[model samples]
Target: MRYYYAEHQAAYRRLGREGMTQWNDLFGESWTFDDFPNRVFLESVLDRLPASGEVLEYGCGTGPAACFLAARGFRVDAIDLIPEAITLARRFAQERGVTVNFSVQDVCAMPVGSKQYDVILDSYCLQSIVTDPDRAAVLAAVRDRLKPNGHYVLSTAMYDSDRVYEDDFRYDATTGICYERSTEPADDAVQLDNTWYLPHRRHLRPKALRAELEANGLQVLSQQGELRGDVICTPTRRG
Candidate 1:
């Protein structure tokens, strides 16, 4: 697990340096790997949040959503594990004329001091942290940083009902890790080849995801979508 976490960190650092630019060039600036339903759902709900509040965005890639929150009157602090990503996010925030505290920090081991947030947003990055314990640590950190009435927004891919492995990818049942080897090879930031590989992707079952959240003291208040699930959670009362 430690080795995989190290690998994950290294992969994202490389991706932050190269993959992000390649993605913007290949897919254009608006090229986000988001499903329309989830994206729409998130924007609609987030936009309706109180005009002013403290917000924390975990795994904020290049700062679009974080900027959006900051622009919407929230005191925003966004963190990403990759230093290059933080650099890009800071530049993007500056370009957008919005203020965001963007920092290079690990989600599992957040570096926040006594500060807490009223809202925490997780957009598809929770599943990227492959190992169960690591994911649990992140959830616990979120619990610790959130205000009593604070909410956590999570969006993630759902496991296919049939559990059929796509030609290019395979899900390991034992480790709950999904690995990919692309057949249509091309020069890309995340090289999906025999030797080079992309980061681990986890497609979680809705029941399992909810259970884990509950175990971490988060209670699911609502959820939306099928192919991709967007859930809102609130911290549960502790004895």
Candidate 2:
């Protein structure tokens, strides 16, 4: 199994079993109401959205963003690869008193069955897709499921130019891949220099990342931040 898939499922399984509601527990960040809505980039995204329309949130974990949009009267459809995450997402929507269509499916392989959304969101999911093919597939899915004038909103961790990689984590600037060193090797981990390294998130320079989005048919309209960037884009139209 892919490392991210397994890791994501494990997180959700723990959340569901522990009765925990928050999904943004990674990196010591708690995605609560106090922080999530007030995020600068997130606020920008909210400002760009239509007053009311059909929306899809790709890789929605526990339905925070989906429920947030739905509570304000936007019809929301969200999907995640983990069934556990979807179950908890349904509960989260209920707790928020909002109705959201939550499905358990990989965004890379989701069937775009005649439903084009006005807006599609990728909430911190793109960086997790490190492989070229999977990243392209997910972007293609976003393009295929979007209306002609639909917007694609994304939040991702960017390569911090000021930070230096050391200790357990190091970055390969050439491939734009980050590796987490571990004592034990995962089935998918790479063994180099007698150390087991797991393929972690991809943190591309903003310019390079934008080029990728464009290559995959998304034309970025605007972006913000350096270490963490939030982008809004639309599908590119070809002659």
* lDDT against true structure, model 2: 0.81
TM-score of each: 0.76, 0.88
Relative to the true structure, candidate 1 reaches a TM of 0.76
Tens-place lDDT per residue, model 1, 1-239, is 33234444554466565645312333345555322224576686875365689999988877777787787789998988766667777876787789999988888777557888889988667777766677878998999888888989887766776767776666766445676664444332144334444335777777777888899999898877765478888899889
lDDT of 2 by residue, 44-141 (tens): 66767787889999888888878878887889899999999889888878876889999998876776578899999877888888877778889888
lDDT of 1 at 83: 69
Report the lDDT of model 2 for residue 153.
88
Top-lDDT candidate index:
2
Clashes of 1: 0
